[model samples]
Target: MNLLLAAGVLAVSLLGGARQTEAADCPFDEWRTYKNTELRRTADRKAYFWITSRTAIDADGAPKAYHPDDVGKPCGATGAGLDCPSNAGYPNKSWWPTVLASDPTNPSKAFVQPSGPAKGFFVSKTALQDSANGNERDTARYVDASTIPYLVFPRPFFQLVGTGKPGDLGMAFHLETQKQTAFIVADIGPDEPLGESSIALFKALGGNNPNPRNGSGVASGKVLYLVFPRSVDQRPRKWPMTQEGIEQGAETLLDAIGGMSVLQACATLD
Candidate 1:
């Protein structure tokens, strides 16, 4: 498949947990650069990047300035918002701030995607804070369905605070529309090791997904599994398998995630 088409599909998949933009926004085609100029006050401020495969035209027939934050509550574009539904069901509490960066190329307009989702932003707390609106502008407004076929990386690569390394352990929340329940993947392997303490933490929060092998699970290092509802149906068969297997799977999955160089590979960001 073409690169643009692949991105469009990925964007739609991610929106499954959220909402999709309208039909006019389908077949995403171009990428527009948006600058969170407000983030300039802080030394940490960096440009947020967005890739769009579709475009949207406003009532005026002028291209609309897009910001992905309009989708749901402020979930840290990182992995935090994946489970945002639990926060309040509608307005996600973890959403970050976002805005339509002024397009340097087109002085009269803001940065925009030419083809896919009409708008998307690289999310960063610094950028939102830098803006006078903070996280409210995007989070406050209802998501316009016209924007789809896009990906919202709350935090773009260059914006990560540290080395931009993936979390030692990655945590994600997925909701099966049919089941209407949340499935969380609390990755504890590679850079992030999980042990009895982490398992206990899961139990404490009333959430499941504990390391199956016990303390030895982290000895060699591995990805442990835990599922909500704690039902065998929702769990990964490999989970609770053996310490050695946990280690193997963790390594395998990490390799797929930019080889541990980008962010800790997450089993399910979809």
Candidate 2:
């Protein structure tokens, strides 16, 4: 790991949510190195393990509200001691919720629906480490690389795990589409409401591709395939907030990825 790079992440956090401000520039040396750095600095090392799953209902049974803080919380573990810098600015994680209006006649308060494929909550971890045995994949009790990509990968923007345990305010919900394709995951809290626009994200994911799996059986679940397209042909006029803006914002930000496709296509390359 580069001392200079690690120092840079620490330097950023001093500025009050610096992790969120300058995440785009963090260097990717190795996943372990990245995560180690975050664990060293943040509260939860595995917080970034996230995915797009069915929209979930909060304890109050109300829809979620879209907050960038909630989206950044998973990757925010850098503050807790994980390796990777929180808000490394990778455009990797996807957390979308519906945008509601303030009028009763308008009839859109962003509530979680009763039934649909986008019904449950989305939860996943990028790499599962057997902390007990100090084992990761391919080590008899470690996280297998081949199986990593198969478990619902996060949106192509960020590259941290969004995995949080049950009832940790570690989950997010989508309230827009009922289709199985648009579900994204986030940390859940009891008083929190479900989000509507993020639900749209749960619906926007492209189909899964056949990801290579090592000996481990981590790839057998119903996972979402995060495809970083080649050449972001478009740009965003502004940050996403509204229905159209959210998807458009994601698409625009995703387009800015450099060599994301090449790297993703040959992800196994050392």
Candidate 3:
């Protein structure tokens, strides 16, 4: 029994030493660079860019909604004349519609409702705080869908890189075909799912499915994200950025990332 116990202790010590040696061989600092820029490619040529998502309820505790029909309707039948709805979807209080807002161009339109079943991209109140409209975290007017598309990097990276901040532009490219799209870093995401873009941005890159907000358009390990930190346009940021603008921005971003040559090569093959 004494011999057996001694052997068991030796074996445990050896195993622990092996683990310590392996850990020492791979230091955290060496891998920390991946936290800011990681490009993972699969055998099938699919790529994944890891980043976080920042979609949460506003200070008033309301989820954001995008309503296309809000062009001409009043919010409710009474109260402060605010056009907010009472039953907007998820992250919103069941009794109060805090994230609702009216169309600035046409106030007669009803407040935009939560995207119950439809598919689209709209910045959350948390995201809207960084926009040109200033911080309206408490008001229903924070739910505008016409805002420019953007993404958020981890807060540490955001501070370190000083780019991809709110309103700054970034680009996502498809490696196999070298197809690309442009976007803004307008919102933050959770920690685990590091790399995420809006449904609209994903669609722009040829991702299937209409609703990305509901996790329908994610192409995991397929899109390559190249972010340009602090690349905000000098002119006033346009709402619902034009297709031409998107295309031009993509082209510029591709050139910046040295993907123009790859894009041309792929184009010639097609």
Candidate 4:
């Protein structure tokens, strides 16, 4: 093993020992490092560990609420194309780039709906989907971020963690704060940044803002994400996960890693 992987294995082994669990035999013990983040996996294939700096706000799958008041009326005020940046000084919608697809025909304009019921709605080209609706290929409905608490991944993080697709991974918790919440791997973000979640997720984690453009912010090293690769498959396939269901799913995954005490015992990355 390389130096980084060897160090990760030693760290994980020490952590496991601290919790009195058998030392984890990490098959994919290789550690990927970013700004201040590190991720690893267990030999048992139970989870892909995430030690992230912070979690950002994501509004993609949430209801079509963008304005400060959570209303969509401003989205359709223009009657021609979606009022993408209904607010002035943001015509390009730079803060909200992930939602809009590029207009191949018009290099400057995004491919937002010109006029319709879903005119101002934003859909993730790959990650946004209603899990309860149907198969991702045929009947998958779009996710509503307001209704569901969900986690998001950077494009590269998805491949790095080895989760097959969006909605396959499960669960996230704040280590230092002890804030545990259930989340579907619901959205894919940019290539480098990580820790993006739905408005509801932010609220669950104790945030006041639901606006994607200018929501709340948290400092780095506050949130810790522990993902069970394909753990949603542990339970029966179902759409529209309920709070009770989310909690139960979280409980199950947490139990797999020996409960909160497992990581809580060693929240700091050595």
Candidate 5:
């Protein structure tokens, strides 16, 4: 390789390693960077990362910007309703599919696919909020973005966090706004382009006018997200996971990792 190219590669490698070493001061654990995103884990079972904030709407009635279908804008994009796009296509086809049919009637928001593997009912492509809101391929119910605070990571990250399903892990957030909230692992997205959270999580972090339908989430990298894996309760939880429960559950785990103040210090590692 050319001398300049080799030098550039070396600089990136050294910078990444140095950052990891600085972030993972704990001997028992280590840190790793991906696509310039910095994340760390402790032997005591805590995983934390500093990333940007982007809004995701994976639940029923999760529209403020673009209405994927008629769930939120049941009456059509006029009265408290978001108008359907002339072309019905969502950014990622998992949570909201490219093809959708909505009921003309209100409150009976049934989304149908003209034809597909999930033809009978509108299937959610995400991992969390199963049975309806997520992967179960049913009508959207529970896990409302207007209420629940959620975070999305890749499936591999979930495996790396180790031993937890959706809503099982406790998450904590510290935004540049200095706003913070307890969140849950509620969805899974692509492996790259990290930093995606629910609409409530966006609002929780003081994000203004959060939007998800256009695949537009906050792009500024001034947010921090930390998760405690294996912090799940012995029993699985039902849907409609409450923010109160998430906060209560996250408290002890955050304390275990030296509390939110320490996490704040971590935000400066890069």
Candidate 6:
């Protein structure tokens, strides 16, 4: 075996021994990391694993109510405006649930409709689009019937995966034979689902689903997710991430976890 891959195997072997002892006692509320854990079998016949990170849903399901006090008159005014955010009607429409800024910001200008009764968070318009090709929407961002990312087995658990706060760098890693890529938890999804990633992240991991938004490459659970909670990079303090920035961020995270050498082995795997 190559040196990097060999080192990775050794690291996993060492950590596996330690994790085995604590596996029986790990707390439910605290975050944790996992290695080489198998996910649900996929049709594509790939192996999948996961690391500890919290995920939320961002797609359509049931309708939820907004706080009356937070409700405005719609269309940026009071008293019978055009139902500004959701336009569903008075008290039925949704608003930015959390205060993103003291004064309204440009990127945070849009409003999201209630996907279901549990809906509580919102993401920027840019978060729903792709940086590399500039696709304006994603399956997770829509409430349509044909979307692939929207799951029914466990209800519609679609949302950007991140802390509601902007610039949150919570991320998940997709590992292949000798390759891996990083993705920021830029949106949220259902609370029950554990294996979801952004369309961009899915594509980066070599997913062949035709529709970037709906079809998942990791369907067979061949991908491994190494999630880093509350790990957002604070230097840029920006929303939509650049490709270069994402690559750098991935390296930074691997470094933090002492997995860089292991990842190097993965990159060179045959």
User: Which candidate has the highest TM-score of all?
Assistant: 4
Q: Candidate 4 regions off by >4 Å?
A: 1-30, 34-36, 66-128, 131-140, 217-221, 235-238
Q: Which candidate achieves the best lDDT against the true structure?
A: 4
Number of backbone clashes in candidate 1: 29
lDDT of each: 0.24, 0.23, 0.38, 0.53, 0.50, 0.33
Summarize candidate 5's per-residue lDDT along 217-263 as a digit string, tens digits.
Answer: 44333555666665555336545556777777776666666664454
Q: What is the TM-score of each candidate against the true structure?
A: 0.18, 0.23, 0.47, 0.63, 0.62, 0.40
lDDT of 5: 0.50
Off by over 4 Å in 3: 1-149, 176-178, 210-214, 236-240, 256-259, 262-270
Candidate 6: stretches off by over 4 Å? 1-166, 170-177, 210-219, 261-270
Put down candidate 2 lDDT per residue, 1-270, tens digits, no spaces: 222232233223322332232222322222332212221111223222112222221111112112222333553312221112122221242321111112233332222223443232111112222335431111222222111111222232223343222111111111112112211222232222222122123223222221111111112212212222211223222111133332343334323342222112221221
Residues 81-200 of candidate 6 have per-residue lDDT tens digits of: 111224222333243322111123443343343354223323223232233443222223322211212211112322323212223333233332323454554443323446544434
Query: Candidate 2: where is the Cα deviation over 4 Å?
Result: 1-29, 32-240, 266-270
How many clashing pairs in candidate 4? 5
Least accurate stretch of 10 residues (summed lDDT) in model 1?
A: 53-62
How do all the candidates rank in terms of TM-score, highest first? Answer: 4, 5, 3, 6, 2, 1
lDDT, model 6, position 167: 32
lDDT of 1 by residue, 78-111 (tens): 3222122222212232331122333456533333
Clash tally, candidates in order: 29, 77, 23, 5, 3, 30
